[model samples]
Target: MTQPGIDAADAASPRRIRIRTCVATRERHSDEKLLRVVVDPEDFTGRRLLADPKRRLPGRGAWITPQLSALETAEKRRAFPRALRLSTAVDTGHVRTYLAELADGPDIVRKTEH
Candidate 1:
């Protein structure tokens, strides 16, 4: 069932993991460590922010560290619009709420190796 020179593990492993830079901290991290945000087009005010944890949203998106401090720093520096390349203002309230919920959720207990 195996090819002459093919390794099954190599075929199963991801070819490449995406790396994203946080707009707030200007630090590089894997896509899993950051959250993607996009402008809420449905909002008539065009200033609302939407958290795209799944990273499936269309159009331009900005990456930020999944921490309250990082979100605050991005807001303070007004980095969303610039990162998203949108001229309209962006409201990060939704993102803040999402992060808060994540923080308050039950902690995952990791199994320790003896």
Candidate 2:
């Protein structure tokens, strides 16, 4: 059960939902409906992007709706670099692969729903 005031909504709110805005669509969505993209942890150049479904990666992150169209729009409009405050060219290859897997792999287990 939630404390009296925390996440208060008649005490029936199981948890406070995190809302994030999509850089691509300029729309607000709950974290559950968004995909977070961050600079790859292993890349110091800060140019390569990684799609973080788990939302656990460290660094500046940009949220986008988890859809192919949204991804394409963000990439086409070059929103990541601006949102991430990066001056270098941003690459989305890794994130593309992750989204592809999500589209094709029904067996894939998503872990951050809660």
Candidate 3:
């Protein structure tokens, strides 16, 4: 059952990806280029932050530039708690380590500036 004017190909094709703003850089990028951070539920020691690369985690999540520098800047500015809308202290060490590992991976493309 196809619509009158809509092509079957178009319907079968993937939907457009929604853009997300980097909380650190305030720049808009595709969701894939941004890393989503969420509070670590298992870390009862404190409010620890973890990267949700798959973006399938529950609860409030904050998006940041996937680059390590941007993550560091966000940490310096204390953006996580405010971005996550939580008063509890947020730890970004895990997120930093994750981004660092990704940046060092051979399969990940490193963006270059002209």
**How well does each candidate superpose onto the true structure, as a TM-score?**
0.79, 0.79, 0.78
Model 2 lDDT per residue over 1-114, tens place: 677657757676456899999999999999999999999889878799999899999998999988888889998998999999998889898888888888786785768966
**Which is the winner by lDDT between candidate 1 and candidate 2?**
2
Where in model 2 is the C-alpha error above 4 Å?
Answer: 1-14, 107-114
Local accuracy of candidate 1 as per-residue lDDT tens digits, 1-114: 556677887766737888999999999999988999988878877788899999997768899999899999998998998998878777888999999988789777999999
Q: Estimate candidate 3's alpha-carbon lDDT, on a 0 to 1 scale.
A: 0.85
Steric overlap count per candidate: 0, 0, 0
Top lDDT hit: 2
Candidate with better TM-score, 1 vs 3: 1
Please give the distance, in angstroms, between residue 14's alpha carbon in candidate 1 and its true position after superposition.
2.7
Worst 10 residues of 2 by lDDT: 5-14
Using lDDT as the measure, what is the rank order of every candidate, best first?
Answer: 2, 1, 3
14-101 in candidate 3: lDDT tens per residue? 4899898888888999988889999887877548888999998777888998899898788778888888887877778789889988
